[model samples]
Target chain A: MVELKVDQDKCLGCGNCVVACPVNGSISPETAGGHGPKTEDVIMMVENGVIKLFNEDKCTRCGTCPLFCPTDAIFLE
Target chain B: MVTNTKEVKGKDICVQRISPEEKRELAYKDDVCIGCGICAKICPTEAIELGEIGAIERTGVDESKISIDEAKCVLCGMCSSACPVDALDLKLDEKSIKDMAEYPQLIKSAEISDDLCIYCKACETACPRDAITIARILPERSKLVTGEIEIDKDTCISCGICEEMCPADAIEMEHHEPTSSDPTVSSDITVNKDKCVYCLICRKSCPVDAIKAVCRSCSYGDYDLNPEDSETTGSSFIDEEACVNCGWCQEICPVDAATVEKAFEGELTIDQDTCEACGACVEICPCNVLSFPEAEFGEQSDKVQADETYCIYCGACENVCPVEAIDVKRTAVKHTPTKSKSWEKQLSELKT
Candidate 1:
């Protein structure tokens, strides 16, 4: 199990993490109702032009998203 | 029954055997083999013998063909698994082994396909065991075909780093199966072309000559004031003929809009009509190209002059001026001396 957090102030909204994530449906754009949890409960979504962790349960803890973040906004604990 | 006996050290050696249940055969595809001899070396039971090219030519067979003795084969499937080009096939229980699927503990060798190889040397640097050797087949020929990569099975540990590092995907790992721990995922730097501003800061910082960026417009020119006032003030303009494309402006720009490319040549000129006699340019000039001629009493000091031959065209003075008086451009008229030395001396003597 792992925890994911996004620093809204530091994120440039480059969407580099979205492209680097190996898991599908893990990172996506935020919707009006916010992102609902998929089959894999872990989800990262963009809301108000910044990245946010919608759910943390489904994450595989691969840490690929953090590795690709150019601004170092995403943190995994 | 055994036949084809040969005497070795006074002992009879049986090279051929006939048995129903123990029958195992190895097939070779002659056209695909590059005569690398990787398969014959990796065979655990020594059932496959790779003959020399000269011997094979005399025997009227393909130079790369290997002889497989069925009697000595244990059907461990090492030869077929190690073949870089699917050139060898192993048959057991009359069914052809379709997949060379087995993660052997020791990887004795690896092979690369010459046709698919781009000779990038990513594998040569990535190999941890130092077993791979890439040489030029013909130094005088084209560089594309010059690299001929070979692996020494005796020294290879089957780490599979070469396969993972190959940019062209030309290398194939034999005997040792790739595992989740084998570092399959490779990292690469990618740029979004649409989002790029072409500032060329990356190009300036690069230690290697990998990134090339060229900016043709005055967008890369640095001005202290608004860019919209460029036409009205003519404060900053790059002389492309003089620019060496060193990317110094690109590194210093705050907006990341600077690019170094071909543009018109410019010479420094002062507009006498708009002159305020400000000495900011003279003080800021690194090259001391701008200077104000001393004026005597009753003589007006209203203009600044630049020595055109000494100017490096760095645009430092143009950016520091409060009033957009100095125009650094290609077409500005040269400044002419309005005061004579005799007139200045006569005026000074009268004032004293």
Candidate 2:
């Protein structure tokens, strides 16, 4: 298991991580098609202006979200 | 059976379509893609679409700006070739057609030669897109200059004059209040060695001659260090994804290290009859080609001047002018040729 943390200051909310996450892709095709998730049952989604984590159980600890982050806002431990 | 798959690796997103006869792949980069919508506009199959760019940029939210429809896409590579930032890639049978001679390739490019570059950082300042970044390491200041400072405790009356007068804030005085029985005050002064630039301001300001200081670099004719030991060295890099081929770097570079090929060939003209000389176009021009001539004899200039040599022909001036006085005619767009009628139609739209 890994911990996911998004630095609010650094994050630009570009949604690069939302498209990159395998769990998000599995949950809905809208995310895989390069759009934000329409369903709520996902690991993370863009809310208000920044990304917010929802279903932590869906995360496979893939650690791909941090790699795609342009501003280094996401950290997995 | 046909299968479609997707994968994200770092900044790159790759989508693959496989069948019995052929295998095709398309890749997009998050960092390189500026969400300019050029690919979406040029897509022959209408497979690419753009999201709300203005809302996403203003809010700084996690929202995708570009999306592709796999079913509608034919993997023709039109969108990949039309992208200004080179953010898209299409491959066939494990080989990129862009590398092949049969396909037309965009001749536009930007390059910087390391051997010829002196690291002057002129290009970094001139780039309108902020695409160039230079990192330089200069000689250490302490090695070049040597200094010493001292303060006498007995002579220092704790008047706090030197501490107040210090420009570098290097001096500090700690004061102890006198007891009722004993009416004498006691204090200690300290000079931070690292913070002190040895300007001798505190020493000169001392009323009781309490401070002594010396700077050796001012008097010494020559130091023992070699000239080569203090040489400046560093690297400079241009962000290919961010560069717009504006030719500003090439124009400002003194060493001829930077080279650029522009994306458009065009002419811009201002109608004298309609122009009010509000200087709207001058403020909007990103390439700094347009400017209002200086007023003479305390009279405001009635017209704006333009230097066409640096103009990238981006049509920003035409869009910004409120009076409809400016006309920008794009004679040609620098892109790979295409046989598709839709691509030709899209290319025609850019010329006007």
Candidate 3:
């Protein structure tokens, strides 16, 4: 299974993953690096056009988050 | 020496004339720098850290900026694109395309807030450098060691897992702080046991000061002329109550006048203070020449962890061999030399 490890340092929290994710609930935002495996953060991060969030469990292992990612983050394992 | 200041000093804000030699190095920051051709476009000398856009230096900087690895960058921009005169020259390496592949890793500086880390160890499980140490924070008399974050920087890949999962915001991704742009050991870290009393001179001399003062009841050949324990016994005492017939001290004695054995049994003996406590002789002598007697292995200094295996044993190092610390036999059997899956490296890659 392709697991996903988000790069919070670079994650702009742009919500790209939130929108790209096939599952309704995968990925969220936390200013801090991580969050519970489920649930999203209240804010969003967008960096150099790349986006990321603190929500971990929302990911479906689709790899889509990293695929469309401009920054090449989101390792889908 | 540079303190965090809102005031941009030196080359940070001012446009300084750069030398051709300095223009050679640059590390790119994708976001902070807009890559407005102005940096490349305005170079008075046409010097900038250029990125690979199109065949022509087009409208927008394709991606990547031009900063040399932290230590190498002279920060001189005779060719800054920001210059209106267009004198700066932004040069890149032929292998830059490959460098771009290593980008994310260049940017991440692991950051942490003290409150967020729960020692969940999720990140620990993920870290490849074994750089992240989960030391327990001990309050005076708390009798408990709460987790403290220690990094063996040499091995760290700059991954942000600890920063990512830290519920308490304790871990952070910091900018790569180059210990030495031209890394050189401040001094040699070898132990000279003969002329040396166990006074720990080199340990005090280290700038990074990667040394520890370890005290444990090491085994001494019962026959040692100057047994470190002799001081406690007021010269020496043969504990008839506990003396075992296995007189190891006599066989391995370099000076055989005071043999600890009835004959040359060749068991081997040890000297606690002179031992360097490297555990080397114990691992190699085929007989255990030393032991760290339940020695609460002093809270290992971060440098020790940092130095763990960096020694190449190549003798190339003017300093100690990173390999000297490793026991070939123990490792072959244990195979547990602080494993990590490049968590920091991956974080750095994504950051780029």
Off by over 4 Å in 1: A1-77, B1-23, B54-64, B100-352
Between candidates 2 and 3, the one scoring higher on TM-score is 2
Pick by lDDT: which candidate is best?
A: 2
Candidate DockQ values, in order, are 0.01, 0.01, 0.01
Measured with C-alpha atoms, the lDDT of residue B184 in candidate 2 is: 49
Sort order, lDDT high to low: 2, 1, 3
My TM-score estimates for the predictions, one after another, are: 0.20, 0.56, 0.14
Model 2 off-target regions past 4 Å? Answer: A1-77, B1-73, B91-103, B112-122, B172-195, B221-232, B254-257, B263-265, B272-310, B314-352
Clashing residue pairs, candidate 1?
Answer: A42-A58, B220-B258
* Candidate 2 local lDDT, residue A7: 85
RMSD of each: 39.4, 15.1, 32.8
Candidate 3 is graded, for docking, as incorrect
Output the better candidate (1/2) by TM-score.
2
TM-score of model number 2? 0.56
Q: Which of the predicted structures, 2 or 3, would earn the higher DockQ when compared with the native? A: 2
